[model samples]
Target chain A: MGFSISVEGGQGEATIKLVGELDAAAAPQFKEAIEKLAVDKPQRLILHMDQLEFMASAGLRVLIFARQKMGADVSLYVIGSRGPVLNTLKMSGFHHSVYLQDTYAPE
Target chain B: MDKLTLPAVLASLAELRRYAREAAAAAGIEEERSYQLQLAVDEIATNIISYGYKDAGPMAQIVIGGEITADVLIITLEDHAPAFDPRTRQMPDDDELSKPLEERTIGGLGIYLAMEGVDRFDYRREGERNLNIFEMRRRNG
Candidate 1:
């Protein structure tokens, strides 16, 4: 229904934990977070999505935006997405752009 | 189980979700099938609002309706916008989805997903309106 984002520092990476639904209304917030992260230019961007319940097409656009904003040199990790949320990412072909993991690991 | 209507836009996505759940349940679709139906409907309705009427100004109207008969779920979406047939759009190559952001073209991906998600797809241009009909059936039957 909504999204909450948190940024954490770990070794050489930045981990973002997202919870709740990511749709059109939530995309702006997600975009802002991505923009803020782009400034730091972390070597790795790990997204923890275990608590994220859903993702709309607009949400997918933000993921694509993050990929572009962060540049290819930065690794992107998506962790713990399940059910419809995971299927959506796969169907939209976003799974190919990032590393999908069952859990996040400290870098 | 019931019928509902709402404006056709991203904000109405929740309404579509509710309709999908009701229609799928009435059609005897299981959880997985219902989820697929929801995804397909979302793709189609989203396109009608975002692209079909993109330049038509703000007065454009879209109506979504659905009914379930036995094992089939039927959805009809009609919009008053420039004549456009979603079925005519070519499906984007899956290989192209990962292309660099600048090289990627906008649009068509949602239509592709909707087409693949449904068991049946049909489109008709009536007067100044576009009508899209979609049907979903359980994989086993």
Candidate 2:
């Protein structure tokens, strides 16, 4: 029903936790968070999407934006993406760019 | 079945999605299936609003109707904009998928997802009207 984003960062890695529906309305919030995180220059960026129920194309744009902003030096990981969310990523070809896992373990 | 009618524009997206959720549930789609139906509908509707209506100005009207049987859900969107068949648009091929970030082009990715989300997609023209039909198979309960 709503979208929420929380970012956790320490050492050389950063993880972003997303909860609720992510549509065009929430994409700006996502973009802001990623843009802010890009400045920190974390070597790894992980997105925890276990609690995310929905993701539209607008939200997908933010993921692409994050990849472009972070450059190749940053490895992006999406943890716990399934069902329609996973399908969207695969369809957009984003699955190839990031590591997708059923669970998140700090590496 | 239910119909949601509005002008084909970005502002109508929220309403479009809201109507889809209700329609999907009414059509007996389970939670997971409902989600894909909503996203699929939004993607196609967005296409109609963004590209289908490019020359129709801001007042182009889009009418979306839904019907569900015991086995499937059908969503049909009709607009007065220029006829466009998303099927003709090329999906991002494996070559593009393998490209580096800077070399990738995202031209039809959104529509590609829309097509992949649904079981069947069709586009046709009748006079000045363009019709896009989408179908989703419902899991046996």
Off by over 4 Å in 2: A7-11, B7-11, B54-60, B69-72, B98-102, B138-141
Error of 1 at A7 (Å): 4.6
Query: Pairs clashing in candidate 2?
Result: none
Per-residue error for A38 in candidate 1, Å, reads 0.9
Which lDDT tens digits does candidate 2 get at residues A1-107? 67789987653887899998887657789999888888788899989999998888878778778878888768888999988798777866776777888886654
CA shift of B75, model 1, Å? 1.5
**Residue A101 in candidate 1, Cα distance off native in Å:** 0.5
**Candidates in order, interface RMSD in Å:** 2.7, 2.4
The DockQ of predicted model 2 stands at: 0.39
